[model samples]
Every structure is written in structure tokens, then in C-alpha cells.
Target: MFNLVVEMNTQKIRKDFPVLEKGIIYMDSACVSLKPQQVVKAMNCYYNEFPACAGRSMHKLGEKVTEEVSKARKIIAKFFNAKPNEIVFTKNTTESINLVANSLGLKKGDKVITTDKEHNSNLLPWQNLAKRGIIHEIIKSNEDNTFNMDKFKEKIKGAKLVSMVHTSNLDGVTIPAEEIIKIAHEHGALVLLDAAQSVPHKEINVKKLDVDFLACSGHKMLGPSGTGILYGKYHLLEKLEPFLIGGDTVIDTTYTTAEFEKPPEKFEAGLQNYAGIIGLAEAARYLMKIGRKNISKHETELNKKITNELLKIDGIKIIGPEDPELRSGIISFNYKDADPHEIALLLDSSADIMVRSGAHCVHSWFNAHNLKGSARVSLYIYNTEEECDKLIEEINKIVEL
Candidate 1:
């Protein structure tokens, strides 16, 4: 009886995220996930037991706290199948990308390939580089929101760097990453993956994938905000310039000149978000224990059930990959005559279903695809089938209005 069935262990899981205390269904994990008890406790441990700065201290308390941060780096590196030296802590995904973008030795006439599907976080750095005479080419996504791989390859010829959003935030379209990375490597183009959405839902093997650079935010994955990761090959990071000066990033400084520390330290400037990052480590551990495969399966089922039922309502249009397996937890759609914001308001007021309805920081994608806006329902491992039923019920009422 159990052979063909796999049920997520949500009872134990829901207890971790205390925000369920709201007495409402929270379904917007794609935007920012609710924190678990362990994550909260980790933050508490820092403040209660040993609250001190990381990486530049002689006192026992400071050294111990710093070691925890260092241990977190090792855990993150092992998770990605990389060495500890490859990861750098940043404020969020945007800051992570900027660390690399500003550090690059890019100049006039250098080429970068990206897509219209990218959020502003992934798109703006290259656009800014374009103003300095660096070339930025927008690879168009097909009508169904899938990337055109053949066209992407054709565009990669002679490009110095290629960067794309790993999973689109607007439509939840997962690009064929293995193909993209392989082709980019063949073309001598460095690939950077904006994996803000993918990290929380999918199994990532940076070693097996051989992706040069990757960025993700902790908040999007059941962790704290003001926290994120930037990963790069050690050699590439060593070659890039420093993003900021002063403080620990510098090895030595005088009135006239300064020398910077190696790769990871060089990128992290000033005092950082210690507590948020500590919570991020705890969140990653929680996800690993539960298993990413199980998480993906649970969310895919929810997306399928919600997508099919929502589409049955008259005048509704579902966006992104029709195949639930092609994406993860996000479901973005719109009603023909109904505004997305209005729809969201009704759902929240009447059904207590929490979701996000807006451009979701991907305005370029919407304008490129000729869409107004969309209502998005993103699920996490803690979400249940009963919540899906309630959402479907509320959507039906909204359409009838």
C-alpha cells in the first residue's frame, strides 16, 4: 500500500515554522519563507550564549562565534559540493551579484548574454555594464515562457560572460541548466546562475553542474532576510577586483595604499549580518534533513492541483510551464476581466490564503511578454492538501464576482 505513495511529513514540519500561529494559511514561500523553531533558536543561541563578531578576534567568545560562522561556510560548501573558500556571505542575492559584477575586469566591447525573463536583481548589473560600452544582449524566451536553448547557444559565441536567472521569479520557468552550462563552457563563457528560487526547491550539485558562479537569498528558503550567498570558483574570485575597501577585507593599509585579503574575505566588506546568516545555516540544515527531493515532490503536487483547478474557472489564464515537473512551487496566473491585486485582496479577506500579486520585481519580463500583472501562489514543504482545497474554493468565488 505504501510502495507507490510518498507523503510529506508536514505535522512535524509545521510545528517548526511558528508563523502558523497567525491562524491563517501562508502560501508565499517564493517571496519570503516563514522561519522554523530551530532557525529561531540558532539566532537565540548567538545572543544568549555567545554573541560576538566573526573572523577577527582574540577573545574566546569572539573566536567561538567566529568558528560557528566558519563552520556554517563548510556546511554550505558541502551542500553545494564545493570547498569552504568558495562561498561569501552577502546582504542578499542582489548584493551577491553586484560583488561579482563590480569585481569583473569588464570593459568596453565585452559581451554578456542574459534574458528578458530575469528579475531586476539579475538584469540590472549587466544593463549598468552596458552603459560603460560593455555589450548586453537579451535572449528572448519562447511564447510559452521556456528559454530557446538553440538561440542561447548561438548568442553565446565569443561572449566573455553569460548570466541568467536559474529559475524565473515571474513565471516559475526552470531553464534547461545542464545544456546552458555545458554550451557556455564550450564557448569559453563564464556562467553565473541566479538561483534565488531554485536553491530552496531543487537539489544543486555545483561540482556535478560545473557552474562557475551561483547566487541565492536565505530569506526565500525558510531563513532570515538580510542574508544570502555568493559562490564562485576560487581562481575566478582571486582574479576579480575587490567590491569595497576598509575593515577586514583589507590585509594592510597605510595613508597611501592598501592590500586586500584573498577571495572570500576580499568580497565581504565591513561588519556583516551575522545573526541572519547563522539562521540561514540552520534553515539549510533543516531542508537537508527533510530532503530536497521530498520537498520538490510535495510542492509539484500542490502546483498541479492548484493550476488545474484554478484554470477551470472562466476567464483565467495560467502562466509558466504547463508541466508541473518543469517548475517547482510557484503558480502565477490572471483572470481575464479581474485585476490580480483585486483578486488577491478578495482571497485574503474571504479565504485567509496568503499570496503575492504583483510584478514580483520582474517588470522587464512582464513588459516583454505583454502582461499587466499576475497573482502568484508559492508553496513550501509545510503546505498541505487541505490548504490547496481552500485556495481553489476561494478562487472559484473570486471568479464568480
Candidate 2:
């Protein structure tokens, strides 16, 4: 039954992405996934049919917009096994992380822990806080770039918060979040997962993980760009000072003061992205229907094929783990003495293959290791074996050159 479902989803997946019709092999899902027709249609419906503000107006179209936005929130909440009130909409993962960084109420001298491999979105906010007297510490990864739980255990002591990446976009390596979250809770530290890379490819239950907060971007999960979600425990969200205020965030305002609304409304300031929110919900719905396990499995198979073929070529260095299974859908590598951007451009010109190159927003890691950058090929459910073959072929040519 599972195989049948996977087969069915695979057959229908390409049709849903209109960009695939252009015969281009898209391998940059780690940066931004191609949106599906369902998500596009949902956003279009919001703009064309009931284009109005949500939660303010009482007219028919306004009410419809309000209802639809509420429904989107619920769908997104259910997708992560979170309560509707616990979910807060933000522009993207960057904004979501910044929201928590600014609002989490960490005092001077309070210790905060993070992994060394965090993206700039997860790294900069804490670094800024450190400049203001918050003791921000980083736990370096193992030699293979895997999470070092021992280092984490040592660093986590006296930490008020542990904000780390659930999956490293730099290498496609996922940390053991369940174990990390458990240890953090035992130490009385609140846990916030930078789940921008994990949530779209796997099933994540915020309650099960016992994560205090989680942040992810919709654009990486077949949703529209400029849409993202931040999920927190209801109590934690309630306690947080509002990151952005004014407009819909307040219930009543006086000349002296303004009374704020609760949880989600308080966090989502000003006018919301109504159409983007609707599209994001549809994207979540589409992923649920397709099954995240299926997507993960399909991506791993492609990665294995690519990794095996690439290994046959001399001086072709792959990042992260030696095993493709450990890297999820990503295969970030570099040819000997080759500029990653030049290789990316060559691949695009030669084979119509699109891949991401350079530091990938994790410049700290590259700088720490005294390296430049690597070419990354990130996959998704819509990718196929033929696409992997073309990638291998082009990469082989690039290496030969």
C-alpha cells in the first residue's frame, strides 16, 4: 500500500510543477523549491476571488478572507501537530528566527547555545545578542560535520536556550533533534529548532519533540516565497514580548499605551500576507497528501545514485558524510581547483541543469575550515533518476575540464 501511494505521488508530482514542463532539471530545492499548481491556484483564488483584509472587515468578502486565512492557519498548525494559536506567520525563516531572538527575553549573563553549522538566519541574531552581553556559545560539530552530542552536553550546562539547526542546509545533515531536545529540557533550557531544512522533508511533531519553538520557510516546501511559520508552545508564545507591534497586534490603543492581542495575533503585526498564507497552507496540504516519508525516500535514492557515480571520478570531493543516506537529498561537492560558480554556470549552459553554488549562507563554516565554496545539488520528490543521470554526466564533464 505504501509503495502504491509512493508510485501514485511520483506519477502526479511532475504534472503539478509547471516549471518542469520547460525540460529543466531543478536541483536547488535547498534554496527554494518550485511551487506547485495547487499552491499557485490557491494564492490566485485569494487575490482574484476574495481579495480583502482578514480579521478586521465584516463584509462578505472580508469574512470569506478571514475564514480562509484562519483555515490556512489551522492547516499549518495541524501539519506540525501544533495548536492553531501556537502558530505565528512571518515573512520567512529569517524573520521567524529574528522574532524569537528579539522576543525570547534573554537577559544579560544568560547563556545561549547553538551549533557551529547554523545558517546566517540562525547565527546572526544570536551573535548580535552576544554583543549586548548575552553569552552566546557554539558547539563545534564532529570531524565528519555531524553533531557532537558530547560537546553539546558540556556546552548546554547553564544555558537558558539552545537554538540550533535541525538540519544543516550547508551539508544536508540532520542532527538528532529528539535527543537534543530531551537533554535541553532536562537541563531546564528552552529549545528552538531552525527547521527550515527538516520540516519540508520529514514529519515533525513539535509536541513530540517538546521543542519550545520551531521556525521554517514555506518557500522550501512548495509554498510561495515570502511565507513562513513560527511554531511555539502556547505558554511560551504568550510569555514572549511581541516582536512586531501595531495594526492587528493591538486590541485597543490609548495615547499613553496599547493593549496587545494574544499569541499569534500579537506576533503577526500589521497587515498579513493573505494570499501567501493561503498558498502556504495549500503547500502543507499537498505535502501531507504526498507523504513526507515518500519524498525523503525518493530523494535519498537519487542522492545515492549521484554520490556513487561522482565517487568514481578522481579529485571530486563530496561534503558531509561519506554515505549518501546521511546527507538526505543534498550532494554538495567541489571539483579540484574549480570555482563552484563557474561549474554551476557550465552545468546550466551545457545541460539546462540548475544548481546552487557558493557558501549557501553558511559562510562561517567555510571560513572556519579555510575553504571557498562548493556546488550543491539539492533534490525533491519531483526529481527523477534521469535527472540524476544528467547531473552526473554534467558533473563528470566539469571535473574532466
TM per prediction: 0.97, 0.98
Clash numbers, per candidate = 0, 0
Give me the displacement of residue 36 in model 2, in angstroms. Answer: 0.5
Off by over 4 Å in 2: 1-8
Quote model 2's TM-score: 0.98
What is the C-alpha lDDT profile of model 2 across 81-140, one tens digit per residue?
Answer: 999999999999999999999999898999999998999999999999999999999999
Model 2 local distance difference test score: 0.92
**Residues 6-78 of candidate 1: C-alpha lDDT, one tens digit per residue:** 6557867887877796878898888998889899899888888878888888899889888888888888887
Q: What overall lDDT goes with each candidate model?
A: 0.85, 0.92
In model 1, where is the ten-residue run with the lowest total lDDT? 1-10
List the pairs of residues colliding in candidate 1.
Answer: none
